[model samples]
Target: MVDCPHLRSIAPMKTSYLALFYRSWPRLASKALQATTANLPNSFAIGLFCVAALCAAPVPLKAQDQDPFYYEIRPLFENGEQLGQVYRFRNVGLIQCLNGDLLAFVEARHDVSDHSEKDVLMRRSKDRGTTWGPYEAVWGHLEEDHAGWKDPAPVVDKATGRLFYFMNTNESEKRLFYMTSDDSGYTWSDPIRIPDSLLRPEWKRWRNNPGPAIQLKVGKYKHRMLIPGHIVTHEDRHFSVVWYSDDHGESWQVSETAVQGSDEVSIIELSDGRVLMNIRSHGELDPGLDPAYRNFMYSDNGGESWYGLETKRDLPWESGHGSLAKMELGDGNLLFAIHPLVVKRKDLTCFVSYDEGKTWPYKKLLHEIGGYSSTIVLDNYDIAMSHNHGFRGEHGIDFVRFNLSWLTDGKEHANPTVQPLPQAPESKATDRAIWREDFELADRTILDGGSTAWKILGASNAPIGAAVSNGKFRTSDAGGEIVWQTGRIDIGDAKRISIAVDAIKIGKFNNSDSLRIYYRLGDGDEKLIESLSFSSDPQEDFETYRIRKHDINVSGNQQAQVIIRSRINGDDKTLYWDRVEVARAE
Candidate 1:
């Protein structure tokens, strides 16, 4: 187990440089005067006096003082490690048992990718996330198994203290299976497939994915066990629902579909007995629809039905899995964790909502580069989070431990300063130029697919394909058909728009490898303006790609948007972009 040291408060150091200078200057000056009066060399005395004056300057502030929030981040599972037969871990699930022990479950993948043959692995932290035990294969085989066990959702029945663990099998007959542990997760019963009576006939053909589960403690559904989940009907149509059991773990029933065009749902019961479901929008799966945003809904009939699909404008997260849990503190505070970006999956952030799930005012960044996070409120009011990341170039699962005070302390763990992108030469004196981004600086707070000045509109789930890395905007084939667009930019009295970009392909290109650029004019859909396909031999160097004004037809629209997308077929291949300039016709 790799341990991340806790951040300690640093005391300001006191140095008397001014006093030393004051005492040394007088003696040095007196010695210089005596040397001059005694007809001896005074050059050495003068140099000593100059050195004392330089030493009197005040010391600069320490690096720790500039940014002081250092929460604990530890590694639980990483890539290339011999943790049983698995090489990677994904889809994390964490819960604190009635016995005050932390049970963390993850999908142990045979490969780094998502669809690899997988198993459900477990680790227990008896001391509240400070330490963890060895990896135990709870489900799937110790050797390679053709069937995959995915998406572990654990919920403990407070009334009976029985823990239920639910997961799905990736076999030909994708079915939901669950096990129970009476002794607080030390052991689990045999895997039992969910009864056919609980599932809708339409859902049998659809792909189902499970998220975190919660045991309701309020109103008419006091002891109901609700597991939030979703089913993908097609590439463009998916919705969220809940599977509930009122009789402990004996029988379960599926709820009505809540939000359409969404995936990976998490639910938290509000004070008024309404369950709030947060869904990740799947706009990227359908090009006819706009880019996705964080969406939400509410169910009042004890998780059986839902309504009100509202977009959360403030939370702006990428299209990835997030976790939500209600704090045990009787104040009705809710804890949420996500990638907190519109385009890229970086900066895993934890948010606290004091007024139920209405608003989130406090947040803390847990990991710089994170994906698919699971959060659980501990028995002692602290938070234990398990997430996916490649720390120090090794990808795996990591756990973070923090509290409410650490989250709301207003200090940041990563770089707090936003670096300005370099200005383009064409934009220096042009009044018609609306927006430009060179991505010269690093700012974690800036939304993914966007800088401080422009908002990037794209699929937040495509992290491997689109990101700002190594001082350049990079798009890789690993991200798979990535498309990113900017918000509308006003064009003032410009007949035509021109853009210049520097791009490069990191590896050999295939037949379908190409970079396509498009623009959307005033309430119109995106229209292709230029498509650059690589037909030449493999080129591993950067090349300038320019879009002339005559190549595009703006149709006299006052506002327009530019879209950049990559269609490549290869592995470990990247396309780097820099020095992007947009200007009016000269």
Candidate 2:
């Protein structure tokens, strides 16, 4: 149960050297590739060779390679186990310098209790990230550096403002450290150690791993610095390599080719530079048991010859950790960040690509399916992700500011001051129903005689639901308890609300039949909002009703809440809620 589908690689799909390098071209595009659930074993023991050529299969080009979505993943950082020493900063990046003037990099992690971390901060946006300037510590976690520099990949050599922040430091064991700020990032120089032959000519049994950054797009490959190195956890040998440098910082070469899956490093470069090295193959079904999905190998000789390994390409990655980014749209058109549409119930969607990573077709959700994300590149490119959100002890780091046609051509720009919202505040567009309260949204009540007692296990209900972790939804309850507490109506200056509800409980009593009110909107599985089951009345002693003007849908401009669920006798329910209204029915 702990593995509904989060990261399961049952095992059994042996072929080694990555399925003999995609079975060596079985006659042009035979679909693509994804058959390694896993059984394990065999390397140079060759016999599967599949390349199948890979062109003209889906055949549909132009309009930015037939766009869709998957453009640079983002989920800055979190903690309870991954970011809380008082909660350091975040891991952001946006270095637009061919000469456009914008610098954004934030890694920061100095929360000491002995998870063994040290300061790794940096922040400076100039004018791209909408505003940022309190994060100073351009990657330096050294007392003697005991381990803790975390994720980083800040580049800005658009011809020398000279700044680069490549992280994951520890000095004697968990290697791969970098930092170089000539003055644009404000200040810094100390931590530099990206040496890596892979560290083991025999150094007393090494230990190092933390890699993320394959940013290219300004000169492509023969030396376009495509770096993506990882081998830092989950019991070593998860192998992730893709290193290339053409003397910008000076010397590096490991073109990335040692694949086994379990986060085997992705190196995104498309924008004419073309460098997509995404590798992850555990087993189509069984082996060491950890290969639920993802597999690829394409190197037009850039990463130094990768003869096309394949898998039937089309992935909304139902497993975790899959990110890629590339943006250029001024009408130049080209945006991507695909594969991350997993769902156990929590937010984990990354689909949106105007053709670059090859294909995603359309999507841009950071975390609404659950866990892990990080995508930042702003300064008119407008895309700042950061997800690891709600439902896992209330995970934090969920901020979204989007564009690129709202994730590749779904085209949405109507926030021009959101007006079509007036479900209540008395305009009588139908009956004045606009309402907005800072009650953190949709759930917060506690009473007895006027009976309104809800604790759907906890967090009163500002958006709470988890039939015990199988359905997934919660906005409050538990120590920080306050799941819901907002019933004050009338919202004017226009905010957000589209109403319709039914579902409540508060210390049941009287044995008379006759009650029905149901609601489920917003957590309706990634549509973002839509679910309203209605009806209510048990003679109203308190657990109340009213808010069905045809169920709401008022998308933002200020204030919004529409969540209601009440069932009796079915799951043994007790109810509450009253005449919740909204106006401007459109």
In TM-score terms, which candidate is top? 1
lDDT of 1 by residue, 1-586 (tens): 1112232122111112332343356557656655555644577766655665565544432322222332466688766655446467777888877777788988887775556678778899887776799887676642213456788888888777788888876653236778788787876554666765655656543334444688887899988989877765534467677788999877888888865566677788777778888777664433322234566788888999987767665576765777787764433455464554534667666665667766765555566677777787655555567777742224788887654445555342222122121121222334244567666566222334444244334445455456676456666564357766666777766667776555555556656787887777789987776777664543222223445344344567788777778766666455665555566754
lDDT (C-alpha) at residue 216 in model 1: 83
Predicted candidate 2 versus true structure: per-residue lDDT over 1-586, tens digit per residue: 0112422121111212232233233432342322331333444212222322233233422232311321232233344343223454443444544334445444444553224465665444454343445545454322222355555566554433456667654433345556676655565544555664555442222222222354354553433555565443334445545556667676666544344443434556555655666554432322432344455555664565454554424553454444556555544445444334545435455555454545655443443444444564444445565544543313434334445443433343212211121121222234444542212223232321222222332343323322211011222122222223223233444433355443333232344323333333333321222332323433221222223545345344333334343222322333333333345454
On the 0 to 100 scale, the lDDT of residue 209 in model 1 is: 49
Error of 1 at 121 (Å): 1.2
Report per-prediction Cα RMSD to one decimal. 26.8, 26.6
Q: Scored by Cα lDDT, where does model 2 land? A: 0.42
